[model samples]
Target: MVTRTARHGSDDESGDADYGHLQLTALDGWRGFVAEMHTAPNLLPTAVWTGLAEDKRDYYDDDRIDHHSRLLVVQTPTIRQVIASGRRLVQLNRNAHSGRCGLMVSGPAGTGKTTALTQLGKTVEVIHRRRHPHAADDIPLVYITIAPAATPKMIAMEFARFFDLPISRRANITDIADAVCGVSRDARVTLVAVDELHNLNTRTRTRAGADASDTLKYFSERTPATCTYAGTSLERTGLLSGTRGEQIAGRFEHGPHRSVQPGPTMDRAHRRLGRQSATTPAPAWITARARPLPAQAHPRK
Candidate 1:
């Protein structure tokens, strides 16, 4: 069974602490985990809202999103391909006997890899609910963003957190893996979106020959849920090199177009600004100057 500590909040507040705020602590812990190979107090947030205002902005700007939906955006073609691959996995989920499938989307920053996967997640959730109404309790999509400073232990902890599982530094890796697998198995989460996968690159410094690739391979081979990687194309290629590439490609091949409209087009900008200007209050002088020019100097008749 998974146990999670309740987030501390003022009694005056009506709601629980936002999950995004907790992610900062989780991310900090991930960084410490990489260096120390153990969980530490550094994972706790100094201030809950420190870096999250921007995330809120990004969250709102996501396309095809509604209050109940969670969306992420990606701009790169490779990342888009990975999201497409995730869709294919969900398709295969209809054939449960086929086992698990993994999808890799790699690319550089500002390429919109995360954004693409987010849009894909929304689609998967809707499809899964439609296909398996009986399993409505299950989260159709689980989106996990890898912190840049993440460690294997931190990764495990994040998974535990996501499923509301109890986690301590003393927990065993195999146990953590089992717990994660169990959650996916039970929840029927058709797809797992892992963004910023390159964070696992630190594992390369270890003598065990582990790297982000190894971590990717572990998730690919272990979890029943379809895994999708969202990163730069260059990063994706690097991640796919060697044995792991084969595993990723074998499980999921590329599929059809799943693109969303890119954010904030120039036309949209003009419309928004024009509307704002029209409604905004004007200075008394400006308002008086614009007083219909004395009814068009009587020219209109």
Candidate 2:
């Protein structure tokens, strides 16, 4: 049986009627109208699309993947560091009974924090699949996007979907938290990535006092999974300076940055005041007025 709830809004020419007033046939007609609005004219189906629209959109779509690949090209060092840290966490989890760690990857936008975390999760999943090909599928990682309007219950529900856990609408915050912890414990998930953490403060107004530091600490304390907070530098500092920030900081081990050399197409010698080594490539970009030079011209004297 279908249940309908009337939302507060302006009524049409017809007097306001409870949404439940629509008969099955009328509901079908309404569904057809919506389908016509969204579908391409030439491809419209004879039957109407009657499915309920989903609120959560998949974050890792094809476009997202392409964007991430380009991000990796520009932020190779950060990507490498994130991958290495994730691998270290996986190894630690395998070695310890109470495997818990935390990482805060902070940088400006377009710096590849989300992309790095996504890559890390994929790497862990690949390793897990190779190790236990025959066993039942286990969730090796969980990724959640925190928004400003996010509540503890909403976060729990998102985690529930990720783990394919059955969650009733009546489920409380504690219940959802328990489900998440339970899944991590049973599935041996290596890490949990929380993206857009800055959104957390915006989403949960009531839980504004809920210190991210404390929540993260409690999560790590109760689960064997490492928690990675990927967001802006400001968000990272806020979390790190929060009540349980020290605990969070202690769990993570930071990696060093690596310098990248420009490609062969670019020339560095003319750009530099002093003579340069033949082996070193030029910077990626050059001014439009600069003249192109032969590779032999860059040879060491």
Candidate 3:
């Protein structure tokens, strides 16, 4: 939410009226545009507030949102790190430059780790496609969510599905990996996001998680795309355990410890991440910070 001070006309307008007017004015420039990291574009119409009673309308139209939640992505320190890492990855992938670049985003469940990646993927897709409009088969960004109890085969199948390929479940992991990597290289997919990475650790006292991590490591090593692994405390999972984990960790442009937190302290952190140069050829990383809603403001389920 944006806060603005407005001058109320001495004539019938009270402070509340002036505030509402100010808010509506702010929405004028923002309408129809999705803020960075936000899931949906702002569709609020300013004209609706012209002659309506204050209590007659909601500031945000929930009906405008589809089944998916439209919560905005706040670019706290963690998000900035993710964006910077993605930019660096894209740079490395340009002109077939080989680099085992990756990024791991880990935090508590409600810390917006998935949300950050989702928006980042969307942003990267748009920017990359716009820059290379004539390049067909150039799938700049592909996102794959790790399912519960997902195996390496299952994960490889997910990739095949994402690419709309018809691969049987009985296919060998090596074959699946090769097909996916070949397609990724041909398609020029610059970034690949694997969400809920912690799910690999579901089977404890076994090497299942390690094997899953190995698949990811192999994929990262083979492909030119930047791999992003995100989940709840993903760094603490088996994905980051032992010697192999050390090798994977070294590929990250940013450390796993960085994460977004709520409140004024977070605001201070955002200010310190340094602004991106406008003249730089890289995509402009958005730096909007979302304000926290009051405890009672959430709508009841």
Candidate 4:
């Protein structure tokens, strides 16, 4: 997402620092964002915050929010698995000729599909940065989101936008696709990520989805990258069902980022809780802290 720098008035009292317009799809923006992600925000404890004067807390409060935001995404097991599989695949497909195997992360929305996928890219990108610290032009990852009702040209343009390729108004889909593919190849981009894959609905009769699929296929084949995707119920969307879908699925490894998992029933859980609470004795520390309430303070409910 692109955000404009906050415009502060001359008379404004709060002087919050502005981290301007972070759009990570582009190279400069992405590099800045990665740096930002690495720089964890420092927040003081509640006692320190309470001691601070109200007039000087705006900046500190903002910092606290930043710290909390960074902590929101916990690295779950599934994300770890995705990162492992993606790294392995990129290495596995490095010397492949064509029809390279890919990774697809699918589950319901809000299941960290985007998070897992982006983390995969960051993991690889970090390794590349560490290996070739001086190679600034060696961008090893590309991430783009599929817009709603996106066409083949639209998908190609997202790639062009990420690489910041110069595209004229009269340029056709082939022009954009070729430019993107050439830049990706030149940049030695090894991980190509497409988020919001659910937006590219191939069920439509206009053949736009099919064409979009072809555009993606072209990228996977033309550019030396492991194409990874994240979306909601991709199999149910019929994205991996048709002739092309079957071929794509045949070469792809599917991973589920499911939010729901089978576990002990609620009744069993309640009984377990009851048993623990009824039989367990209070700790000495808790007993020491407790005080008997007056009769007026504890009228029977």
Any runs in candidate 3 off by more than 4 Å, and if so which?
1-69, 93-99, 202-205, 254-301
At residue 291, give the lDDT of candidate 1.
Answer: 36
In terms of TM-score, how similar is model 4 to the real structure? Answer: 0.78
lDDT of 1 by residue, 1-301 (tens): 1222233233214464444432422433322222221111212142542455775434332311221142222234544445566677667765665447666555446645655676677567666667776874676666677766566666766667766677667878778878887877787766777776666553353322244446555765566567776655433334444565455556654332323333353245445555665788954322432336576578754
Task: Order the candidates by TM-score, highest first.
Answer: 4, 3, 2, 1
Predicted structure with the largest TM-score when compared to the true one: 4
In model 1, which range of ten residues has the least summed lDDT?
33-42
Candidate 4 lDDT tens digits, 1-301: 2222213332224555443325767777776655543333344555776788774456555544444455345466677789999999999999998879999999888778988897898889989989999988898999999888888888888999988888997999888888888888789999999999988788763387787888888888889899999899888777888798899889999998854233353345445555665689964423532579999999798
Error of 1 at 17 (Å): 8.0
Please give the lDDT score at residue 254 for candidate 1.
39
In model 2, pairs of residues that clash are 147-199, 148-199, 148-202, 148-203, 149-202, 149-203, 150-203
Number of clashing pairs per prediction, in order = 20, 7, 0, 0
Q: lDDT scores for all predictions?
A: 0.54, 0.55, 0.63, 0.77
lDDT of 2 by residue, 1-301 (tens): 2222223233522467544332111223222222222111121121321231322112112223323233223335457778887788767766565636666677666656767776676667667767897754576677767656655566666666666678888888788788879878887777787777766442233345254434555666677777777766534434545444455556665432222334553345322312343446643221212467899888787
Best-first order by lDDT? 4, 3, 2, 1
lDDT per residue for candidate 3 within 118-165, as digits (tens), equals: 657766866776788688457776677777777788888777777767
Local lDDT at 46 for model 4? 56
Q: What lDDT would candidate 4 get against the real structure?
A: 0.77
C-alpha RMSD values across all candidates: 14.5, 16.2, 12.6, 7.6
Q: Where in model 2 is the C-alpha error above 4 Å?
A: 1-75, 97-99, 201-213, 235-237, 254-301
lDDT of 4 at 143: 90
